[model samples]
Target: MKKVLKVIGITVLSFIALIIILLSFLLIKNYLDSKKPIIEDTYYKNFQSDATLEKKYAGLGSYEVSLVKLKSEDDTIKEYKIWYPTELKSKSQAYPLIVVTNASNTAASVYESFFERLASWGFIVVGNEDKQAGTGLTTSKTLDYVLELNSDSDSIFYGKVSQDNIGVIGYSQGGAGAIRAVTEYDNSNKYKTIFTGSAAYSLLAKNMGWEYDISKVAIPYFMSAGTGSSDDSGEDSKTSFGGVAPLSSLIVNYDGIRNDVFKVRARINGAEHGDMLTRADGYMTAWMLYQLQNDEEARLVFIGKSAEILSNSNWQDIEKNN
Candidate 1:
């Protein structure tokens, strides 16, 4: 009887332990699965190749449009706008590609000024529209769009685009999208670099309680927050709590990872979110150029201008090594 009682007690404990372990595993798996975004099959088929792209574009000049379809392994069509130089260096020399995720969410026309400058400076500027958004923007649902554009069948883009030398520039929601897309995808370094302005850090998405994760990002990211963009706590209290603005605090407070990260500039004094894009500041141009092409002159320009835009003392610390 004593032996039987001891055996029964051991069996009960083992069963309880097994149940607890199984429950913990299910909970953990659920959490991780929630973080991953689903890339649907229909979305992949929308991509158009170079031959099909040239047919779609019917013009030629210093500024001509080229369409690129990022067809995923699953056959999804990811759309992109390729802005090529009016003249190539030579048939053999491929210009570096710059992928700009403009925050304006406007038509390509709205970005003419910035794109023109990039082209004049010798880059093949490309832009993508976020899902269900304006031209040249890309959304969280459309991240594979970026991946396919840099794929192997993209032979036309092979010699045309300088290695995977790519840069992503985003304004507003696009800024947040740029970071989130790369973080979730984990290919920023594999490509080249990223730049953002007047960023919306997806804190609102996470806090409002979505399962998006921007913390695990591994890339060289640069953010330029405008001077008056920070919402006061009182103002934040009165405003709706679920929008993108509330998340800024999350970004300011969180310090998960900062590998290949640099806060190149945080413009000060009357610098609204949109103004930074239009103005042809040497540093703004330089930072993009440096990140995209490793140009020393551009790096010098960024270092010099960084001091002026950065208002926070903390940012000063980040600026020192950058």
Candidate 2:
């Protein structure tokens, strides 16, 4: 009986110790994640080129950026964050708008610098606190809220958002959200272009209840992933043949879109899934610039024989039906 009691006590203490260790690790990780810069120059360093579109768009735009946060009653999408050009407050011009979907376990607050950078380029960027935004419901609702604000006479976004020129972008699970945001909702036709970074592939997305049908995607599309082990872990014979969004999966998605719809798909050579959020910012930004703003300089990066991305060393497996 004494021996049994001792064994029980030992097991309980071991469980407590394990829990403590896990808690400590989580605390440390949160602290480190918080310490990371809102924007890092290292990720964009490789894209810098004096004569290329990368040099200009990868860096900050001329407009100063500002952020606004609004509370929401929805439980899943608790709030919305809007990053815009500060000049919009005084300037009479309308700016393009981009709706950003958050990756799994992340929110707009966690990637403020990314939105700020895009806003600096003269785009109004919006995102929400939906950590599990794969469903697209929150993304659609957030867009509705923003459009409503655009019509409110007293709102800052009033008469400032260009209704016809809008885009949607996502990374990881949010990549799935971006797809559904344009394909699954009533406001689906509002987006002019879509971009995804390491979006969750079909198998994984279905398992997570975030399945998206790219066949319904009719607008300009740009999708990219990374070439790291985390993104290419599974074997062909396995049930889970790819990680988040492997080349094979991206190819499948690219093929699903109608041939007439403009689409481009590629992967960054050394970047991992997480690295894609900012690593591909140069081309990603240029895609929006070309598709939504009709910027001639940005167009050179995607079209013509001298298209920069095709020859860029950082990218591979380029496929596009222009």
Highest TM-score against the true fold, candidate: 2
* Candidate 2: tens digits of C-alpha lDDT, residues 125-163: 998889899989899999899999999998999988899
Compose the digit string of candidate 1's lDDT tens values, residues 1-322: 9999999999999999999999999999976764343322122233232322211111112333344333333321144555566555235666776666645334343345455545556677765433312122243333334445446453554445675566666665555656655555444444466666655545443443222355555555555554444421224523444223332433452344453455443442345555445421334455656777777654554455443324322122233225
Full-model lDDT, candidate 1: 0.48
Clashes of 2: 0
Model 2 residue pairs with clashes: none
**Residue 30 Cα positional deviation in candidate 2, in Å, after optimal superposition:** 5.0
RMSD of 1: 15.8
Error of 1 at 212 (Å): 5.2
Candidate-wise lDDT, in order: 0.48, 0.87
